[model samples]
Target: MSKPRKPKGRPVSGWLILDKPVDFGSTEAVSKIKWLFNAQKAGHAGTLDPLASGMLPIALGDATKTVPYVMDGRKIYEFTVTWGEERSTDDLEGEVTQSSDARPTEEAIRALLPSYTGVISQVPPQFSAIKIAGERAYDLARDGETVEIPSREVEIFRLTLLKCEADRAWFEVECGKGTYVRSLARDFGRELGCYGHISELRRSFVAPFAEDTMVPLAELAALEKIEDRDERLAALDAFLIDTGEALSGLPHIAITEDQAHRLRMGNPILLRGRNAPVSEADAFATAGGKLVAIGEIGEGEFRPRRVFT
Candidate 1:
């Protein structure tokens, strides 16, 4: 067996934003990346179905700890919806359960989008990963078992109909975590009196990051062809939180090197500013103004939860 050639692409750490290619699940993309860098720990913030593609931020090494922060951020997707037919999965990947001839007007679609905005209740599809009892809901759904999926509240901060055509519409959605665009498409069709499903989906932004920061698949793939020894390490810290403004907002607590050591040893050094509130989640905890560890909000005190070296 011949040895595989080494890659020449930059050694990436911290974070890498990819324009995820279609036909690959989010896990598959992360797996490929892990192989590329030989990275032991890494994770992706959002889960994109095999049929969908777009900005997927991957965290590397210690950056994996920040995955929860990224996942909790807002997501924006531009999706195309067909107004005539609906599918069981509420997307193009699913089987068409119904077909109708009712066409929707642009004006009507615009009016419907506003109603979905803000906080509203929604029911997840039966064919979803949500667990019911001890079995996965989607598993039961595929097995032809009747599943009682309940509706829950979700916030759609923005859902705008960007453009429309006969029996079709394109929309840009900015929603909070846990929102299912497929469910929205289903609801959209139901309201228009015509069943429909999502035909296309693309995530463009993830609050702090956007498509502009994404590296194109075509380019990343081309780099794979080059020799490995030529690649330079890409510093991962570039993806860290905007620390300047956050630091300024923090109560300026100055501490000496001796105090810094004590803080790292699980000691609570007094915050210099009296009665000053520490940030809810301060990535860097300062004692006497020296960065100690990550801090958490506690009852009238900031506690060092986890320290990132």
Candidate 2:
């Protein structure tokens, strides 16, 4: 029998809402954060394009378990769509594919907002991370192969026109998962009889994480200068949000230390007391303010699905 190798680095767990700057890739940001924190595990809730800037929720260690909850949450973005030019990628990074002299008026843009709101079918941009036949759409696109990407239903909770000028328009949108702002710009251009592309985009919020809670990459980088390793790690750790905080949108139940121990041991605990939930599809259990397990509540018991160590 072979001995299992111990994982390296600290077992730090929590979320870091990074204010990702333009030109930084999501995977690259995760790598940097992992290096900075020296964590044994790390992952991100969603992918933010290199050209986009905004809140990117990253999970370290056990916090990674909660990433799916955040990824499914709503997202809000403020973007500038430039008129008269549509690009291959539907953004400034791609080559110009079409052009027009028409520009939509503020009234016209506002009138179109209702059409985009609610559930609508949207085709993702060619340079998107969507996979086709097990290959990334972007990779196939880069190889000069255009694939028929299927349109998906995405919900735009809200869309508002902030301002409209001769060549550009600023807008804010609150949307559900899989909604592509780039696609919105592309479709808006096509609808208005004017070619359009995203010139600037910034994500202001991802669900369960406040806009103000984001820490800029530059601020995190500055902590590398601390002389003492412990102090440096401490400073970085201070920015981590609680592991359970990511599950704020889900139902939660607090359990006793004994129950928490049973959950950790992969056993179901019976729900008791008047306030105990009789049934819940999904819920998380916490003990002394710390996450214990995420599970389903049924048959008057909490069945652990994922336990936090």
Candidate 3:
């Protein structure tokens, strides 16, 4: 039998809350971080558009397993809607599709805020990542083909008008996963009798991570100047948040080393004490402050689901 192929690169693990710069794609950021760290595995919790700058949580090595949790968390964005012209892509990148000389008053825009709050149906932009028959909508849009896109429900926890100018209005929003700020700007313009598009957008926060935790791309890039390879890598590693920190939202229990060993060996460990959980669909276990496994609790036992190496 042929020998199993070993993966290259260091087994670095943790979350890197990147303050992605505008015009840089999410995939490109991940690739660049992967190269800089020379990590064996890497992934991002969510996709931030090239034109939008803000908090983008990236997972390295074992932290990649927890990406779904971060992706499902709520996001907060501060955006500016430029009235008078709506673009094809819903942003400045695309050509103007519709235009109007009329503009909305501050009072008029504030009056419409309540209608956009809470659960509402939204249609994604034509230049979106939504798939149509296995092909990306953006690809079809670039080809000059217009397809009917269905509307889906998205929850907006909070929407506030920050400031309003003659032709531009700034707003901040806290919304659930899959909510599109660009679409909100588009819809607002249509309803107010003035066409609009996103002039500036920045994600300020993602759930389970603080807005202040983000590290800029330029700050990380500057670390590349260190002469010694080990010293340089160490400088980069300092910024990594513990992998277990990402699961702060989930129920957690600290187990003994023996229990961690059993979990690592793909075995379940009994839960002791009356306060122990009777049942749980999702939870995580740690030992010596290190993540041991993410699993379930039932019948007074913790069953290992995904064990960390």
C-alpha local distance difference test of each model? 0.73, 0.95, 0.94
- The candidate maximizing TM-score is 2
RMSD of 1: 5.7
lDDT string, candidate 2, 1-309, tens digits: 999999999999999999999999999999999999999999999899899999999999999999999999999999999999999999999999999988888888888889999999999999999999999999999999999999999999999899879999999999999999999999999999998999999999999999999999999999999989999999999999999999898889999999999999999999988999988988999999989999999989999999998
In terms of lDDT, which candidate is strongest?
Answer: 2
Q: How much is 282 displaced in model 2, in angstroms? A: 0.9
C-alpha TM-scores of all predictions: 0.82, 0.98, 0.97
Of candidates 2 and 1, the better by lDDT: 2
Task: Rank candidates, lDDT, best first.
Answer: 2, 3, 1
The TM-score ranking, best first, is 2, 3, 1
**Higher-lDDT candidate of 2 and 3:** 2
